[model samples]
Target: MRTVGNDLVRSQLHENRKWYLGLGALLVVFGIVLLAALPFATLTVIYIFGALMMLGGIIHFIAAFKIFEGGYRWFWALFGVLYLIAGYYAFSTPVKTAIVLTNILAIILIIAGVIRIFNALLFRAFQGWGWTLFSGILTLVTGVIILMSPDAPFWVLGLFLAVDILFQGVNYLTLASYIRREVPKSSAEQ
Candidate 1:
């Protein structure tokens, strides 16, 4: 499948720039708060994750019975059960869950980074490919560090999370500004 680019997202969003600014500001504020109260925030994050996992498990459990056919149904049901147990354990012991989550995050980041770098190389002729390559290198390094030192301080994990939020906020704000500047042009083109 083709990846949806900025043009697609830009077309889908409303022309109202205010919403973007508001959301970006909210995310930045939350990031700041999380950074300031890292320990509590980390715990809070774990709790939220636990809840989501539980919800996913419940949904999967239902799907197993409702949608799957014959033998495949058992697999989904088993998967759902696993999710439920993991979610329950996460809720019961958030600290331990956070540690596990950190390792999982590291693995995911590494994979994502490799993908980004490969794509950046493939599209090196395009503008901003260098940025993608740079970002991917940073991501890969962060993941490698995390993987190597899985027992790093909770604060480090918290800092990473905060940085992610801050970057996301900045990106949103930038996109919002760009949209604001191009609103008239976009409207005209439409």
Candidate 2:
């Protein structure tokens, strides 16, 4: 198993660099487009949420029949019932869900920032660690700002989302580009 894993890794290590670079470019472009359409994007998110609720309800109703046929009727029936209830709640309180989702995003960003800061600190023992520290500090600041302003309107949330996506997209692009340049020149080259 270990040998198989090693072989897989070795094969991947020799794969063409253009694939990673292309993916990175796509991410960057997506981020830019999302940032550019922040206002419309918020509405799109709300619509998607509503659609998901309707779909969930339909799926649950279908599952109820399947569960009855399977003879473990009570357990799956309970799941279907709960799902229906959640679907109703989603349909009735979509605005509330949107607000909660925004808050969740803030919390997630804060957690991610804190983790990155910790990782940067841990990696500081290694050489050439300044860039990591800088990135960590930037992320921490962004997270703190978002968390402190959790009551921000949809526009503000959209703006934050745009910035976050753009930053991450640029980060990934830079990493991919570096890998593309470094890999062919290194010993891992096939």
Best by TM-score: 1
Provide the TM-score for each candidate, comma-separated. Answer: 0.66, 0.50
lDDT of each: 0.81, 0.64
TM-score of model 2 (CA atoms): 0.50
Candidate 1 clashing pairs?
none
Residue 113 of model 2 has an lDDT of: 71
C-alpha RMSD values across all candidates: 7.3, 7.7
Residue 27's lDDT in candidate 1? 86
For model 1, the stretches where C-alpha displacement exceeds 4 angstroms are 1-15, 107-141, 147-153, 185-190
Q: Among all windows of ten consecutive residues in candidate 2, which has the lowest summed lDDT?
A: 181-190
Residue 14, model 2: lDDT of 43
In candidate 1, what are the lDDT values of residues 1-190, reduced to their tens digit?
Answer: 1224544555656455677788788889989988997777777778877898899899989999999989889999998998899889989988888888888888988999999999999999999999999999999998899888845436556776787898788878987888767643333246
Report the lDDT tens digits of candidate 2 across residue range 1-190. Answer: 7756665655564464566566667767766787788755554565566667667766766776764566566656666676666656655775665576676776777777777778778888888677777776777776677657745535555665667767777776776676566544433344
